[model samples]
Target: MKKIIVLCVAALSLPIAIAQEKITLTQAECRQMALAHSEDLQKADNAVMQAELDKDIAFAAYLPKLDATATGTYMFPDMDMMGAKLQMRGMYLAGISLTQPIYAGGQIRAGNRLSEIGKDCALENQRKARMQVIADADNAYWTYIAVLWKVRMLESYKAQMDTLFRQTESGVSAGMATENDLLRITAKKSEIHYQLQKAENGANLCRLALCNVLGCDLDTSIEPTDTVIKVSLPAELDTDISMRPELRLLHKQVEAAEQQVKMSRAEVLPTIGLSAGYMYFGNIKMKSEVGGQSFTQKIEDGNALVSVLVNIPLFHWGEGTQKIKKARLDLQNAQLDLQKNTR
Candidate 1:
């Protein structure tokens, strides 16, 4: 009696455990969780940050630069003269220098423009990432729902067959129905069982795919709520490709190339700069007398200088000319690509 009671308890616990393992999710919750945990989205966010840093680096050229220097030197005379032995003397110097860019052949301005364009490109990339995530979520949600429906339908069919099987078994024993009827119902039940298994397997695969996207463990249960909102499609799309990010990025590239050409051409122009510095030197003693050493007074000096420079590119083995041609070609290619994509 004890053994029979233990077996019954174990059998009852197994069904309860299985029943407790079911997962339920709503659609909106699934999408939110996926977006929050997606590795691709995280990487896209990092890329945006990197691009912003690059923009900052590019704009740094517009700011003035300050540098400080300190040097100590010990000098030794090459030879003795006038019966005085050559000796080493120590010298210390410190200075601060400032450089402001008065002009730079338009290179700094071009760099700033390119940085802005790059930021726009990064934003477009982020948009693309978001679109991909939403699309993937939609597909996964629909597939899961479809599988659940299929499983329910199959189980309903299985229940009907179970009743028929019992009826046919009783009929055969009473000689009212042939064994063939019972065999047919059993065969149909087996087929339905196989289909149910396949459907269940497919549902599990869909669940795993969703888990991968959400960066969750395979065993984690996700229940999605339905979000099948309907929206009308646009009557027409614009023929011009400029609205697309790929085209926009290409246009920016062309503009950047044109700027580069202009910068290179401006290289032949003159550049002007203004610089200023102040220096202070400590006193140096010449000799030690009875009362005190003869010392030179400390010297403070300030200087301001203005300079203009011109660099004439007389010849560089055709490097500059080649670069200009390349820039023009790139602009043409970008335009063609935009046209192609639009079509």
Candidate 2:
């Protein structure tokens, strides 16, 4: 009798033993996995980098620019001077110039403002992505916990029915219970066994779905260590959408468009720049030949010059005004969208 009971207990433990092979994860661990694998977060990160680069590029417009040029020439035939060759076979010339914008008609400032707006938009988008991924992870995690608990509940119920079936079978042999009671208990045990099977399948499906969210293999199994239960709310939920990232992104876009309009208007205004340049020309050469004997000339000359430059837009057939108009229209559209999203 003891051996028979041992066999029955072993049979009942087989499914539990199999379940032990699955990995166990907590709710926080699941969220971490989801965030690590989220494609939306990856895209948001790229956008953030692009926005930062744009800001740097715009800032560069306010900085000084320096350029240098060098040229060298070799002559196949030497020039003759007073029947004596100049002996200038090769010559190198180099010039370096620096230009700093004293005024860009407010375009540089407006462009910088636009870059700042772009970065704000990108950050808001990243926040939106993170929020969405975290919410999904939370839902998936709770679902896993709920299904796991349901399976556990069904397994416990099955164990109770197993015990009752044994007691009823013994009573039937002692003539203390009817055959109908034994059959009924046996039927209930079978019913609980089937219910546990269904519950376990459900739990496993939820586990697979959670794995999919974490970007893991669908066939991989997991046992959630969290519990799901309804919680009483302390207060009513707020319906305000002002803090939403989509609305913030739209508002930032409107600000950027307004800056673009400022830049366009500035296009018709004059720009002032300061420039400094250094030029050097000449090469090792000989002085004009005298009595057929020449002296080493060492003729190299360099000069530094600074100048102020002004650029005024003379005529563009209303191009600047057209651009400003377009920018204003875009700003208006963005504002309208923001209002709609807010509602």
Candidate 3:
């Protein structure tokens, strides 16, 4: 009685121990799951975000920057000398500075253009990754379907073979069919049984691979609810390669390289900017130990000033020219890559 009870308990627990979600999926669902779980797709999304930040940074170069600073000092001794008392013990200093770029010899504009192109490239790459993932999932899904259907059809054929073998056995006994016929039937059944086993094994492996692609555990069994049907191909198809993402990315690369060349050329030209600042410092009378002016003041209280700045590049040891040449070469390479990929 105890053995019987234990057997019953084990049988009941078997399913519970290895149970998983019995998900039924169609081709679209499988592709969606793969895209949702793919690490490569997630990284492509991250690249787009980073490219947006790069564009923001490039645009910020033309905006003015305002800065403010303050400082405090403390001393043990406070000195009062002459009519002016040096407030050196408790001193405070503060200033504000502003900088605006009036001209950058086309460098800023070229950088901004390059950043825009880079953003587009990232977006196109993201789209390409999504398409690739979907296509891969679709292939795996359909392959699983074909293998499962093959296994099912072979199983039915085996059953028919079994029926034929039984009828032949009786025929041989009745002197209607030869023993050789029965033997051949038996051999054919064995061959089919072997083939059926191979097909079933292939089906199981296909199921596991599809489950992994769809973000399910390897142990989980997948049930595909979709079936393949015959479809007529279009009479004419467009094989144009202009819509490919790879070619688009290469084109963007060429445009960005052209901008880089412009920036490099700008490096040898003159740059102009505007600067304005306001500074203030507390006046303190020197102690008796130090005898001189009662207070330390330069520029008569250090008035505010605004000035225009210019930086002229006189010469470099062929550095700027070499960089421009290199940028042009990069552009040529990008164009060639686009043509190659199109081919």
Candidate 4:
């Protein structure tokens, strides 16, 4: 019975002990947690992955493509022609073809370049997302620390007020202080109490905010183990904006737009391709009679062929030129946007 009671008591106390435990986190740790918790950052990473796949798909245009086909046909009845029966009992064909583009009027190259630019833009966007997350985390961490320090300062001041009130009470008992003075001290102490409570409430709210930023449970207690440090200004400040991710992303956009113009221009140009194929057919029979003689001929054969294909755009009512003009306009717009954002 005693052992069972001890076990029950220990079990009851475990939760209380766990609830009282505080998690100590540093500024760097908080930033790391916030980065891991950021959903936007994760989506940015996914975009980068998708961009890589797009790049690969664009590059595949430069490689050869292989395809296969099979077909079968069966005739239920024979046809009579020229005083004879013609029979095609069953026909089967199998073929495989390989095609490689020799030239595509620079469209394939431009598409690949556009894909590369998209990949670069995705990377830059991811970098920007990381920077934003870190900045938010740092801001939340510093604000929480400031509120905690304010609460500590208010508590210390309240202690000093308490000591003063006690001294004033002692003086009043010895007739050195009046009842009015005692009442004033009492009022001041009450004010200190109210201020302290308010400060504590503010600290709790700040802690909750910090927890939200860190993506942790609201009920979990956190202790920031870092202190605000003094800072000194550098002798000289460098003003350089070229390395910012936002600018890089815009730069990629401009490049992509330029590639789009190239691809549009390619629409009016000629394309060249090479193809090789081999086909096999079997089980085809033709029956006929000539000069009072009947005979059956079975046709089973295979053939291979290689050929070069060329296609040129002839006339489309000025559509190709209009598309190229539109693409050029889009490129110009992209350039203008980049220039505006850079300034």
Total clashing pairs for each candidate? 9, 0, 5, 0
* Model 4, span 262-335: residue lDDT tens: 99999999999999999999987778777888888887999999999999999999999999999999989999
Cα lDDT of model 2 by residue, 1-343, tens digit: 9999999999999877765556778878988999999999999999999999999999999999999999887775667666555545678889999999999899999999989998998899999999999999888889878877888888888888888888888988999999999888888888888888988888878877788889877766777766655588869888887898987878888888789889889999999999999999887465465687766566689999999999999999989889989989988998898788776
* lDDT (tens digit, per residue) of candidate 1 on 1-343: 9999999999999867764554566766767877888778888888889888988998887787787777665665523444333333554567776777778778788777877777777877777777788789878888877887898899999999999999899999999999988888999999999999999999889988887776677776667667354678789966665567666767666676677767665665556555555443332223222345443333334444444444456777987677778777877887777667666
User: How does model 2 score by TM-score?
Assistant: 0.74
Global local distance difference test of model 1: 0.73
Instruction: Give the alpha-carbon lDDT of every model.
Output: 0.73, 0.86, 0.86, 0.90
Error (Å) of candidate 3 at residue 79 is 15
lDDT of 4: 0.90
Return the TM-score for each candidate structure: 0.77, 0.74, 0.83, 0.87
Looking at model 3, residue 181 earns an lDDT score of 100
**Clashing residue pairs in candidate 1 (N, C-alpha, C atoms within 3 angstroms):** 24-223, 25-223, 25-224, 25-225, 26-223, 26-224, 26-225, 27-224, 27-225
By TM-score, the best candidate is 4
How should the candidates be ordered by lDDT, best one leading?
4, 3, 2, 1
Query: With candidate 2 superimposed using the best TM-score fit, by how many Å does residue 310's alpha carbon deviate from the native?
Result: 1.8
Error of 3 at 35 (Å): 2.6
lDDT of 3 by residue, 1-343 (tens): 9999999999998877677657788887898899998888999999999999999999999999999988888865554556534556557778899999998999999999989998999999999999998988988899999999999999999999999999999999999999999999999999999999999999989988887778788777678888865578888987876778987888898898899899999999899999999988774435333466343542224459899999998878999889999989998998888788766
Please give the lDDT score at residue 303 for candidate 4: 100
